[model samples]
Target: MDKAFLIQFTGSMAAVAVLVGLAAWARIGRPSPGLDEARARDLLAEDFPDRQIDQLWIAREGRGALARSGACALVLIQVGDGYAARRLSWCQASSAMFRNGQLDIRLGEVAAPRAVLAFDNWPPKDLAA
Candidate 1:
């Protein structure tokens, strides 16, 4: 192989390796738990013991100029009522952003409305709310 060609190829490979390494490093400490509805429900249950959650919705913030959206999951829990409209806010520290973050649940034409619950850092004294 020509010396110049070999050097160019090696440099390109090194650049690619650096980009991959940077990406991996950046994502290492980040939370990528797939933030699905099931996980959100589990977090809600752990956070709120007495209160029962009937429905859950997860919404991700849009990005870039085009406003590309992220993943979202809808969870339906089997409670006395089918589902209800409720407002919930999850703690930032916890990964329960699905139900915790800024979002609203609508009952619409549903027969029952799901009770909205927010999961905070510390457990509340009374689980009534």
Candidate 2:
């Protein structure tokens, strides 16, 4: 093969490889357990039996340096019929586990709120609160 042609071919391959690597990295940087509204509601129902979930939101927060960052999906659970409100945070890893029916919520920091009676679902009962 001609030297110029070989160099050009190698350069093109390198560019394609870089592009593919970037795409994969971006995907891995995203948080897991990307649940839709219906699935989120079902998970909440199983965790918090009686309370009706009003809304659920998956919040992704990036941590660490930009090059090595990781994302976490925060499940915000909200509940209530009227003016009352409560909130709970089911961390990304925990939410994924629970969504899979593993039930591994660390109730210590992210549990039922005493003042507002929050439920354990995505967008916990009093999310707005």
Candidate 3:
């Protein structure tokens, strides 16, 4: 193979690798068995000790959860090997809706919101709804 061709092939391969990495990073863990409301509250309780959890719902697939604590809505996602959560409040430009058995809550700007909580077959009243 020509040296130039090898260089181009290597560059293309690198680009592909980077794209794959980004795609993987964009998604969290696969659905699991521990997304129930009790589990969600227990998880949040570690961080939000005094606040009351008004509501919570685990996605049908168990990949994500959403909850209302005090004045803010907490969104928890399975990230990496553990979990990650974000708080969205009415103070920000947050909006929520339940469509087709999925609850979608978006906070802040239209681009991506400070946090986006989308739960499949979510239960309870959504904070923004």
Candidate 4:
């Protein structure tokens, strides 16, 4: 390509990188506001009555929750009403990423996508992968 074109493209890319860095820095200090265990337990209990919740992560503003039981993994995300639950039995997740302000976890697919959970990362954890 032309020298001038390459220079302009490099400058634009650098600007984009700087903006992304600033956004990430802003999210650094703000820790996730954890969820109430009692409420989370109650919600998890609704779907998984038999299986006990082993691990739980809730969004800051009570937007969503990621819960794990002995048998399966459950994700309760805010749609329109309250929180809708998505269950994963075999647990074949491919990738999980937290970006901008949302946490997106992708599961393995057969015909279409097996499962996908998109929630806000509260008590923001390091999602460097």
Report the C-alpha lDDT of model 1 over 11-58, residue by residue, as the tens digit.
999999999999999766533344455655655455455555533334
lDDT of 3 by residue, 8-115 (tens): 999999999999999998785554565777778888787677778776666676767767776787777776556676667843423456677665566454544533
Q: Where in model 1 is the C-alpha error above 4 Å?
A: 30-129
The number of the candidate with the highest TM-score is 3
Per-candidate clashes, comma-separated: 7, 11, 0, 1
Estimated TM-score per prediction? 0.29, 0.27, 0.52, 0.49
Cα lDDT of model 4 by residue, 1-129, tens digit: 999999999999999999999999876654434446677778778877877777776665666677767656677665444555666752432235566666665544343343233455433364212
Q: Tell me the spans in candidate 3 whose CA falls farther than 4 Å from its real position.
A: 1-32, 90-94, 97-104, 107-129
Question: In lDDT terms, how accurate is model 2?
Answer: 0.39
Q: All models: lDDT?
A: 0.38, 0.39, 0.66, 0.61
Which candidate number would show the highest lDDT if scored against the true structure?
3
Our tally of clashes for model 4 stands at 1
- What TM-score should be assigned to candidate 4? 0.49
The superposed Cα distance between candidate 4 and the true structure at residue 55, in angstroms, equals 1.2
After superposition on all C-alphas, the RMSD of every candidate to the true structure, in Å, is 16.3, 15.3, 7.5, 14.3
- Error at 57, model 1, angstroms: 19
Across residues 19-57, which tens digit of lDDT does each residue of candidate 2 receive?
Answer: 999999876643344445565555545544555544344
Q: Where does candidate 4 stray beyond 4 Å?
A: 1-35, 89-94, 106-129
**Candidates 1 and 3 compared by lDDT, better number:** 3
